[model samples]
Target: MLRRALTNQITRQQFRFYRVNRSNTVINFVPQQEAWVVERFGKFHCVLDPGISVLFPIVDKIAYAHNLKEVAQDIPSQTAVTMDNVTVSMDGVLFYRVVDPYKASYGVENYGYAMQQLAQTTMRAEIGHLPLDRIFSERAQLNAKIVQVINDSTVKAWGIESLRYEILEKGDIHLPQSVMQAMQGQATAERKKRASILESEGERQGAINLAQGQRESIILKSEAEKMEQINKAVGEAEAIKAKATAVAQSIQMISEAIKHENAQKAISLLVADKYMDAFSNLAQKGTTLMLPTSVHDPSSMIAQAINIFDTLTTKRKDMKSIEASNEDKKPEPEK
Candidate 1:
C-alpha cells in the first residue's frame, strides 16, 4: 500500500508538470436539482450544471454549493395587534427556492432568516391594517399579501423565490367578555326574529288559503241555489203551459159536444154530482155544520147549472155568427 501511494503521487506530479493533469482532476458529480459555483483564483466563475464537471486543483475551486430544491421554514408564533386593537398570535410555514445561486450566495448573507423575518414583519403590518373580523375571514388573502411583500422586497434581492406561505396556527384572537356576550345576544335575537317572521308568513298564507276556500265554497253554494230556483221556476212555467193546453183541449171537446146541443145538459149533471160529493164529505168529517139552505136542493142546483150553460152556448153561437159574417164581408183574392 505504501508503494502504491508513492507511485500515485509521482504519476500526479508528472501529469501536472506536463500540463496533462486536467484529465486526472477530481470530477464533481453534481446531483439533479443542485448547483455548484466554481471560482477561479477567488473570483466569480460560471455555475456548474448537473452531471460531471472539473476544476483545476490549484486554480479553480467550488466556492459555493446550493440545493435548488424547495425549502420550508417554520415561523414561530408572534403577537400582532389589529387596527381595532385586537391582538392575535399567528405562526406559519414559508416555502422558497434558490433561483440564482450567485445572488443567493452574494446578494444576502442568509436568505432563509431574512425571508422569515420579512414574512413576520409583513404579516404584522398587514394584520395591523385589518380588523378582527377580516383576520378570521381573509386568511388566504393575508397569506398571499405576506408572500407578495416578502417576494417583492427582500426575497428579490436575495435571489430566493418564494413559492408559498401557509398559516399553521391561528393563535388565540380574543375579544372582551362583554363584546362576546353582546354578539351572542345579537345572534340569538336575529335568529328569533327570523323564526317569528317565518311563522307569521306561514299563518298569513294559511289565512289566505282559508279565505279563498270559503269564498269558493260560498260561490259554489250560491250557484247551486240559483240553479235550484231556476229549475223550480221552469217547472212551474211548464206545468202552467201543460195545464193551459189540457184546458184548451177539454174546451175543444166541449165545443164539439155543444154542436150536438148536449154539452149544456152534461155540464149541469156533472155540477150537481160534484155538489153532492162535497156535501157528503162535509157530513162525514163534521169539519162544519151542514145546515141545508133553501137554495141548496140538488134539483134547484141542476136547474141553475143548466141555465148558465144555455147562456154560454148562446153567446158562443152569437160570436161564431159574427165571425162568419165578417169573413163573408172580406173581399176574395183574385185568382
Candidate 2:
C-alpha cells in the first residue's frame, strides 16, 4: 500500500506503483492516535459527548457509531396521540438533561427513534380508548394523560420526561343542529315543569297561611269580646252590691232612730211626701185610689191600700219604701 505525504489515503503515486510493477512493495499503516467519529463544525470538527466519544474515524469503510444518548436529543417532551386509529401529525419540544449517560448511550440503537416509536405506540393505545368527540375536544387533556402513561414506562429506561404536547389533526363528533335543538327543548320543558310545580306549591302554602291567620284572628276577637263582657258583668255586680249595702245601712239608721216618738213623727212627715208622690204616679198611669167603703177615711184607705199593694207586689213596695226613706232626708214644713 502507498500512503500520501500528509493523509493516510493512497495517492496517484500508489497507482503508478501498481501500473509499473505488478508486485513491488508491501506496506501497512500504523496510526499514531485512537480513531474517533467526527461531524463538521464551522471551521473544525468536534466529537459528540456521551458515555464516551463515538463514531471514531477509521481507515476502512466509514462506520458511523451512533450513541443513543446523543441522538435522543431530537425526541421531544410532548407526545402525539391518535384518536381511534386516526392519523395525526404534530410537532413538540422537549426539555431534557441526560441523567444516566451510560443507559442513554448504550440502551438502544437509536434512542430518538426508540422514544418516537414508544410515544407513537402509547398515543395509539391511549387514543384508541377515547371517541372522536373526546379526542378532538379534549385533545390536550388526553395528550397529558397519554404522556403520563408513556412517561411511566419510558422515563426510567430512556432518561426523558414528557413536558407538554400539541395536537395537529382532529376528528369530528358531527352532532347536527337539529339534535341540539331537540336537547334544548327537553331541557326547557323540564325547567318549565319544575317552575310550574314550585309556583303551585307556593300558592297552596300561601292559601294555607291565609286560612290559618283568619282562624287566629277570629279566635282572638272572640276571646276579647268574652273578656269585655266579663269585665262589664263584674262592674255591674260591684255597683249593685255597693248600692244594696248603702240602702241596708240607711234602713238600719232609720230603724234605730224610730225608737223615739219624735223620730217616728219626723218619719211620718216623710211618709206624707212619699204619699203625695205615690198619688202623682197613680194619677199619671191612670191608677185610681179606691177608698174602702167600710173604712170611710182617706188616711185609712191609703194605709189599707198600701198594705194590700205591699202584699200583692212585695218587691215594688220594697223600692217604694227605700224612696220614702230617701224623702225623709228633705226639709220638713214648720212644726
Candidate 3:
C-alpha cells in the first residue's frame, strides 16, 4: 500500500508539470510597430499583436516576425530598349511597407527582393513602350506607372504596399556612331530652325511697327496741310471782306458828295488831275509816245473826259435800277 501510494504521487506531479509546460509560454514584449505570425504545428494559428502573449508551449510557436515599418530599396541599373530601339540603362529606388505580416511571410518568398525585380521588369516593359525623348520628358509619369504596375502585380502575391518608385538617373544611351552623328545633326538643325523662326518674328514685328509709324507720319502731315489750307482760306476771305467794305464806303461817300453844287467843278478838277498824271507816266515809262498837234488844248481834253465820266455814271444808275427791279420780282422765303 505505501509503494502504490508513492507511485500515484509521482504520477500526479508529472501530470501537473506537463500541464504547466504545455499551457505556459510567454512571448517577450513585441515592439509597437512589429507583429508576429503564430502557428500551431506549422499551420497558421493566430496573429500576435504588440505586447506579451502566452500560448500552448508545444503546439503554438512563433512562425514569422515582421517589421510593420516603411522600407526603401535601391534598384540596380538595368538596360532597357526603348520603342525607338535605343538601349538605355537606368537606376531607381522604391518605397514600400508591409501591411499584412502573414501574407508577407507566406504569400511570396523574399517579398522585398521580388518587389525589386518586379519594379525593374515593369520599368523595362514601360520603357519599351515609349520613345527615347518621351522617356526623358515623362519620367514622373513613368515612375507612377511603374509603381502602379508593381503594386498590382505584387499586392496580393507579396503583400507589399508599394508607395512610390523613383527613377534616379538614366545613363547615356549606347548608340552606333552613325546614330550619334545623326542625333547631333538633328539637334543643330532644331536649334537653327528655332533661331530662324525667332529672327523672322522679330523682323515681321519691326516691319509692322515701321509701317505703323509711317502711316502716323502721313496722317500728321495731311492734317497739317489741311489746317494750312483752312487758315489761308480764312485769311483770303477776311481780305475780300475788308476790300468789299472799303468799296461800299467809298461809293457811299461819292454819292453823298455828288449832291454839292461844286460837284461838277470837282469832277472837272479830278479829270484834269488824272490827265496830267497819265501824261507824266507815259513820258517816263513808254518806249514810244505820240504828241498831239495841239498840246495846249487843255479845255478840249477836259470836255472829252467829262463826257466819258457822264456816260459811265449813267450806266451805273441803269444797273442799280435793274437790280432793284429783279429783287422786287423774286419770291421771298417763308417766315
Candidate 4:
C-alpha cells in the first residue's frame, strides 16, 4: 500500500513539473513532431530576448527582428582617412535597424558591431579627403555618405540596414569669428574694388565717346562750311562765265550783222540821225559847225564828210580790237 501510494504521488508530481516546463520554455524540445501534441521540439536556437524562431518545428530555419535601440546607441561621431594616410575626423549620428531578420540574427556576430566598425573606418576615410567645412556645412551630404558606406559594407555580410545619419557636433574643429569677419571684409572690399574699377572704366569710355562725338560733329560742320564756300566760288565763276558768254554772243551777232547789206544801210541811217542831234546840240552851244557856205561850194561839203568818216572808222576799229584781245586773254574752263 505505501509503495503504490508513493508511486502515485511521484507520477502526479512529474506530470505537474513537465506541464510547467512545457509552458515556460520558449523553445519546445521534443524528439518527435506531432500535430495533436501541445509542444513540438527540435534543436533549440538561442533567441536574443527578441530574435529568431524556426517556422517549422522539424525544418531547420531561423528568422527574427531586432530593434536598434535594443542593441546599440545611435552613432554620433566618427573618424576618416586620406590618400596621403592623413587622418581627418568628424562627428555624426547613425541610425540603423535590422532589415533581414535571418541575416541580422545569424549572418553576423552582431549587427551593431559591424555598423560601428564600418562607420568609424568609412567616416575617417571620407572626412580625410574633404575639407572640414564641407562636412560641417550640412548634414545632407554627411549622412548620405555615412549610410552608403555602412550599407555597402555590411548589408550583405553584417545584416545592417542604415536608415539615417546626422551630424552631431564638431569634435576638434574650430573657427574664430574675428578671422571669419576679416575674411568677409576682405571679400567685400575686393567686390567693391572691382565694381569701382568697372565704373571708372565705363566713365572713361563715356568721356572718350563724348569727345569722339564732338570731334565728328566739328569735322562734319567744317566739311559743310567748306562745301558751301566751294559752292559759292563755283556760283561766282558760273555768273562770270554767263556774262562773258553773253558778251561773246553779242560780238558774234554784231560781226554777222555787219556782213549784211541791210545792216549797213540801218547803221548808216542811225549814224545820220546821231549826226543831226549832235549838230543841233553844237548849234545851241554856239560851237562852230563845218558845212559848205552855199550849195555852190560842193567840194567843201565833201571834204568835211570825209574827215568825219575817217575819225569814226578809226574809233570803231579801236573798240573792236580791244574787245577781241580781252576775249583771247581769258583763262581756260575748269575740266
Which candidate number has the best TM-score?
3
Per-residue CA lDDT of candidate 3, range 250-293, in tens?
A: 88997798889879668767867798689879989999989765
**Candidate 1 residues 71-107, lDDT tens each?**
8887767888889886677888888888888888778
lDDT of 1 at 254: 73
Candidate 1, residue 26: the lDDT equals 64
Error of 4 at 139 (Å): 12
Candidate 2 lDDT by residue in tens digits, 1-335: 33334332322233232111111112322122222223333222432333332232332221222222222223323333444444434434332333443344445444454555566566656766775447657867876876688677656885555554444333222234664576589879999999999999999999999999999999999999999999999999999999999999999998888776666446655665577577668768875576337444667755655565446546766888999999998888898
lDDT of 4 by residue, 1-335 (tens): 99978965664454231112223234633332111112224433443333222334434322332443323334444445544443444565667765554455557654554566567677776676665446546447867887787788777875567777666554543335664576589879999999999999999999999999999999999999999999999999999999999999988997788887767556555555666567568778876766446435544544555557667867998999999999999999999
The number of the candidate with the highest lDDT is: 3
| lDDT, each prediction | 0.77, 0.53, 0.79, 0.60
Give per-residue lDDT, candidate 2, residue 242.
100
RMSD (Å) per prediction: 12.5, 18.4, 14.4, 19.4
TM-score for model 2? 0.39
Clashes of 1: 0
lDDT at 94, model 4 = 69
**Order of models, best lDDT first:** 3, 1, 4, 2
Report the error of model 4 at residue 185, Å.
2.4
